[model samples]
Target: MTRVKISRVTKVPASEAPPASGECPPSGIRLTTDDGDAAMGLRVVGIHLENCGKQDYSVDGYPLLELMDKDLSPVQGISIVQGSGGISTGTGFDEPARPLVLKPGESALSGLMWRNTTESGPTANIPYVRVRAKQGADPVTVTPQLDLGTTGKLAVRPWTRPSK
Candidate 1:
């Protein structure tokens, strides 16, 4: 059955950035499946990079997602995976790469999914997630932050394969 529902919500972070101690950001990020696309028998997913706070700039660093518990605790031992380059469907290319650098007042969408490996099988005690970018780049810093809304929480699902 196809169902369309418009849910309205507003979320605000307690702070624009995390403290200087490296802690998980608060629970403000939300993930919702694109049922409309999936309903058409597609493997497409949508990720919303909501309010990531204010930062001077961002650049040059690998972004990663960290999973946490309901009490706002790290879910020790879990890997998150994401992909952006579009895939082929036997005819032609559907998505093309054209620089996905998002600035303030901007958001990016791509095909992404999360799985828990701290021990398998659909679990849903998600609390919050943080995005970490490695330090030291070049002219600008690309160090990802846990409060940038760039990181997303792990869906309450288990993994089918191990990340090595």
Candidate 2:
């Protein structure tokens, strides 16, 4: 899991600013990976977002999740499957904002799908998920590697979430 800080700008002086109510610093946000599944010539990658702060947080745009090889090159035939179908692959924006909200200590799950189109066999690559809380906020990228064994077909279970 990778932690990232949310960016905030305030005009109030540090001393004069209101004390933190329940909100957590951006550092409390985390990106994690679940086990992936490959079956019936299809690959499903599990992605997760964890909020460990005292307050809730929201993701502004489509969660940036990509499948890439060890050399950091985009893997062919892998694409993020958006359930909402509102945002296109390029823009990453929706007509109406569909922000994902996670309360403190809560986690959200997303999936990416790919088909093994090669004739040789199943190829091994890494799944990476990038997240940013708001526009102009610093983004964090987390890539966790899992071994699915050598086979032309693959099936991986999602990783278990850590206990609080």
Q: Tell me the tens digit of each residue's lDDT in model 2 across 1-164.
A: 99989763224223222225454445676654456666664455555557877887776544554344555455555333344232213221122334566788887555444444545556555543343434554455445452322332222222223245
- Candidate 2 lDDT score relative to the true structure: 0.46
Clashes of each: 2, 10
Error of 1 at 17 (Å): 9.2
Error of 2 at 47 (Å): 1.0
* Candidate closest to the true structure, highest TM-score: 2
Models 1 onward score TM values of: 0.34, 0.48
Query: Model 2 residue 9 lDDT?
Result: 25
lDDT of 1 by residue, 1-164 (tens): 99988653222243523333323234322222232133222233332332243432332223344544444456664434333222224211233333334444344333333322233444443435544332331111111112212223322111111123
* Lowest lDDT block of 10, candidate 1: 137-146
